[model samples]
Target: MPKLTIDGIEIEVEAGTSVLQACEALGIEVPRFCYHERLSVAGNCRMCLVDMERAPKPVASCCMPVGEGMVIRTDTERVRKARNGVMEFLLINHPLDCPICDQGGECDLQDQAVAYGKNTSRYDENKRAVKNKEFGPLIKTVMTRCIHCTRCIRFAEEIAGVPVLGATYRGENMEVGTYVEKTLDSELSGNLVDICPVGALTSKPYAFHARPWELRKFESIDAMDAVGSNIRVDVRGGQVMRVLPRLNEAVNEEWISDKTRHAVDGLMKRRLDKPYVRGADGKLKAASWDEAFAAIAKRVAGLDGSKIGAIAGNQADAESMLLLKELMQSLGVASIDCRQDGAKLDATTRAGYLFNTTIAGIEQADAVLLIGTNPRKEAAIINARLRKRWTMGGFPVGVIGPQIDLTYDHSYLGAGPQSLEALLKGEGEFAAKLKAAQRPMIIVGMGALTRADGAQVLAAARQLAEQVGAVAEGWNGFNVLHTAAARVGGLDLGLVPAAGGRDVAGILDGADKGEVEVVYLLGADEIDASRLGKAFVIYQGHHGDVGAHHADVILPGAAYTEKEGTYVNTEGRVQRGRKAAFAPGDAREDWAILRALSAHLAKTLPYDDLASVRRRLVEVNPAFAHVDDVAPSAWGAFGAAGAMDAAPFVTAIDNFYQTCAISRASATMAECTEAFVKGRQEEGKTGTHG
Candidate 1:
C-alpha cells in the first residue's frame, strides 16, 4: 500500500495505483479528454497535470503511478497554467458549432473549456478543415471536431477485439479514420458515440432529434438480449428519443450492444395501439377492450381446461409472466410454456438452466469451453468479458458447435454431440486442457439444448463437466447461456409444463388437431403460426408483428420500455426495469391487460395494481423479492440425464439485429440489418470477382 496526499487530504491505496485514481478516491475531480476508466491510459491528454513537491514541473496524473508519502497539489498555479495551455491547443483546430452539435449538452470538452480555457485565442491563422468520411449507418462523423484522443481507436482494438480504427499522418495533419472507408461492423460499435468527448461521432438516427437537457431520463434495462444490460431511456413528449447505457458492474459493465442502444425506434413503429377482433370477412376490425375480452371469453365458453393453452414470449417481464401463469393455472390449464422455440431446458433447478458462475466470475476461470453458442450475437457484452480475459493472458478458451469468430483466440472443437462425448471420455485435446486447469468452465448455449434430442445433449454436456472436475470445492463453472432476457425469470416462477401439460410444440399440435379449443399467445411471434390450425387465438402484445397477424383477437399492451417489471438476466441477476414512457394510444401494461382479461372471464385476479401484483409475486417466488440481487442457485440432480445423441448442435440466432418482434418493426433496425446484409453480399461479390 502507498499513502498519498492530494490537496493535504491523505489516503492509502494499493500499490501501483495511479495518481488520477488517488485523486478520485479523495473526491477530487481531475478533468481530461483521453482518460476513461475502462480504456487503457493514453497519457496524451495533458489536462490532468498536477504539481508534485519533489517533481520539477506538473506531471500527467493519469499515467503517473503514486509512491509512498507522495504530496500532490491539484489546485496549484502551475497546474492551472498547464490546463489553460492544453485547452487552448486542443480548441485551436476544433470547430465552433455547439448550437448544431448533437453532443452539445453532454460534451465534456465544451464544459472543461468553459471552466479552464483562455478568454481569447492569440492565433489568427486559418483553421484546418478535414473532410468527413462515412463510417456506417449507426454513427455519423464530423472529422473536424475530433481531438485525436484515440479513445475510439483503443476501444476498437482492445475491448471490441477489432482494430478497425487508426490514426494516419503526422501530428499536425493527423486524421482519425479507418484509412479506407469501412462500416463499423462490430455489434458493440454504438459505444464509440458515448465515449467521444465532442460531437465528432454522433448517432446518425438521433442527430437532430432532441438535445440532452430537454429530455427526461429514465433508468431501465435492455430486454433486447439475455444479458439485461442496464440503460437509461431518454424521453420527450411521451416518446423514447434514445437509449444509453447505465452503469451495472455485475452484468453489462456500462457497455450495451448496438441493438440495445438503437432499438428505441421500434417502439414508435407498427405498434398495436388499439384492441381488435377478427371479423367474419377475414379482416381485423377495430374494437374496444371489452369487445376483445368478450370475444375471447365467448370463443372458449364450453371448452375445459385441457383444451386451453398459453404460450409466453421471450420479451415478456417476470411480473406479467407470473400473472399469466397464475391465470392459466386457475383455469386448470396445465399447458403453459415460456419458451416459444420449443427448447427442452431443465426447469427443475436454477443451476440446471442458469449461468451458475455469473458474468463477473468469467475472469476467474483459467480455461473456458463454449458449447453451441455464438456469444457475439447472443450476448455481446459477455463475449467482451471473454475477450478481456483473453487479453489479460493465461486464459485459454475453447469452442464447440460453429467455428465462427468469437472475438478471441479459442481452440475450435468439432460442432456436435460426438465431440462433447469425446471430451467426456477424456479422449480429446481440450479435454486434457480442461482437466489440467485449476478452474475450468463449460458454457452450454440454448442452441444445443433446444432440439428433439436436446435433453440428451444437455446430459452429455453435464457429464463432460463432471468428468473434467468443472464443479469442484472452490468453483462451480457449469453454466447455461440463455438468449432471452426473461427465460431465467420465467423458470424461477415455475412457468413450465405441469405433470400432464404439453410443451410449446405439443400445444401447437393440439390446436392443429382440434384437441385444443383456444390458445393464448402472450407476445409469442417466433412460432410458426400456420401450424396453429383453426384454434381461436388471442394475442396480447404491443407489436403488430407475426403474432398479431395470426391472432383472432388482439389486445393492445405496453412494450418493455412502457412498463415497470422485473427481468432476470442469464446469470439469475434480478433487475427491475422502471417505466420510461407512457404506453402508446389505447395500449395498457401487459399485467394490467392480463388482469382485465381475468376479470372479463369472471375470475378476477387477486391483485389490482402493479404494486399488489409484485407483493403477491414475492410471496409466490422469493427470488422476485430480491431486487438487483442474484440469489445463489442451489443445484439439484440434473433432470435431462440420458444417453448420447449423435446430432450436431445448431446456433440459435442468425441475424443479431432482427431477432425479436420489436426490433423487426423498427425502421432504424431494419435499415441497419439491410446495410449489414448488403455489406456482406458486397464482400462476397468482391471475393468472387477477384
Candidate 2:
C-alpha cells in the first residue's frame, strides 16, 4: 500500500495505482477528456494536471503512480490555472455547435468547460477549421468537435486491440483518422462512442434525436439474447431513445453488444404494445387482459403434463423462467425446457449445472480455452473483455471452432472440429501447448452445432482436457453459449429439462406427430418452423413473435425494461435490475401472467413477487444457492470443475441475438437489421416503436 495526500486528505491505495485513480477513490474530482478506466493511459490532452510537492510542474495524474509520503494538490490555484490553460488551448479550434450534436446533453467537454475552462477566449486569429470524414454506419463523424484527447485513438489500439484510429501528423496539424477509408469492424466497436469524451464520435442510429436529459433513464436487464447482459434504457414519451450498459462488473462490466445497445428500437413497433388474441372469427383482435387469460386457462386445464409441452425462450428473466416452470409443473406439463442443445447441456451438466465461467473471472485466469464458441458473434462483451486481457502480460488463449476469425487475440488455433481428435494427440501441437498451461478455463458455445454435432465437439473437448491433465488443478471448467442475455440465469432457475424430457424443438416436432395436445411457448420462437396441427398453442411474450403470429391464444408479457428481476450471467453472480416503465397497453410481467394461472390451478408458487421467485429458484438449483458469494471479486477462490463428457444430444441452441424473437424485431439494432432487412422490412414498418 502507498500513502498519499490529495487536497489535504490522506489516502491509501495499492502499490502502482495511478494517482488519478487514488484521487477518484477518495472522491476527489480531477477532470480529463482522454482518460478512461478501460483504455490504456495516454496523457496527450494534458488536462488532468495535478500539483505534486516534489515536481517542478503539474503532472498527468492518469499515468503517474502515487509514491509513499507523496502530496498532491488538485484544487489549488496553481492547478486551476494549469487546467484552464489546457482547456483554453483545446477550445480554440472547436466549433460551438452543441445544439445539433447527438452528445450535446451528456457531453463531458461541455461540463468540463463550465468547470475549468476560461470563460472568454483570447485568440485573435481566425480559428482553424476541421473537416469531417465518413466512417460508415456505426460511428458518426464529427471531427470538428474533437479536442484530440486521444481517448478514441488509444481505446482502439489498446483495449479493443484493433488500432484503427490514430494520429497521422504532429501538433496542431495532426488529426485522428483511420488508414485510408476503413470503418471499425470490431465486436467492441460500439465502445468507442462511449469512450469518446466529446461529440466527435456519435452513433449514427441515435444521431440528432433525443438529448440525454430529455430521455427518462430506466435501469433494466438486456433480455435480447443469452449472455444475459444488464442494460439501461433512456426513453422519452414511451419510446426508447438509446440503450446503454448498466454496470454489473461480474457480467457486462459497463459494456453491451451493438445488438443489445441499439435493438430497443424494435420495441417501437406498435405490434407489440397491446394485448391481442385470435378470435373465433379467425382474425387477430385486440382482447381484454382477462379474456386472454381465460383463453389460456381453458386449453391448459384440459391437458396432462405428459401431453402438454412448454418452452421458455432464453430471453425470459429468472422470475419469469421460474414462474413458467412452476406453471408447467402445475399444468402437469413435464416437457418444459429453455433451449434444447442436449449436446451442450450434456457437456456443461456433467461439469456442473451452473455457469462454468463469467466475464470478469476470465481476467484472473492464467489461460483460456474457447471450444466451439465464437465470442465475436455469441458473446460480444465477453470477447471485448478477453481482448483487453492481451495488453498486459497476455493470458494464453486456445480455440477449437469453425471461425477462422476470432475476436480474442488467440495463442493457439486448431484447424476446426475435424482437427479435435488429432489436436488432442498433439497432431498440430496447438492444443498441446494450451493444455500444458496453468489456470486454464474452457468455454463451449451451444451454437456450435445441432444436438448431434454438439455431442461430438463436447466429447472431443473432454477427451483432450483429460489427456492434457486439466482435471485435478480445479482452474478449468466448461461454459456453454445459450440464448437471451438471461440464459445464464435460466440454468440458475432450474429450467434445464430433465433427461428424455421433450425439448423446445422436440415439442414442435411432436405436433407433426399428433402427440401434443397443448403447447405453451413463453417467449419461445422455434415453433414457427413446426406445424401446430390440432394442438392448442399459447404465446406469452413482449413482442409479436412466432408464437403471437400463429397461436390460438396470446398473453402479453413484460419486456426486460418493464419489470424488475435478478438475472445471473454466465458467471454465477446475481444482480437485480429494476423496471423502468409500466408495461405499455396491456403488457404485464411474465410472473404475473403465470401467477394468475396458479390462481386457477389452486397451486401456490409461494412468492408474490420476483424476489420470492428468486428464493424459490435458488432453493431448487443448488448451483445458484451460493450466488451471493460469487460476485467476481471472490473469483480467485471460485472452484469451477474441469471438463466432462457430453450428454446424449437433443436439439440445437443458438446464441442470444439469433435465439430470441423480440431482438430481431428491433429497428435501431443497425447491425442485426443489416443482416435480414430485406426479409423483415418486406413485412412493412408498423407505426409502432423499435
Candidate 2, 596-627: lDDT as tens digits: 76776667677786667767877766545654
Model 1 CA lDDT for position 122: 81
Q: Which sections of candidate 1 miss by over 4 Å?
A: 681-690
- Top lDDT prediction, candidate number: 1
- Per-model TM-score, in order, reads 0.98, 0.87
List lDDT for all candidates, in order. Answer: 0.88, 0.69
Task: Count clashing residue pairs in model 1.
Answer: 0
lDDT of 1: 0.88
Error of 2 at 13 (Å): 4.7
Cα distance off (Å), candidate 2, residue 107: 2.2
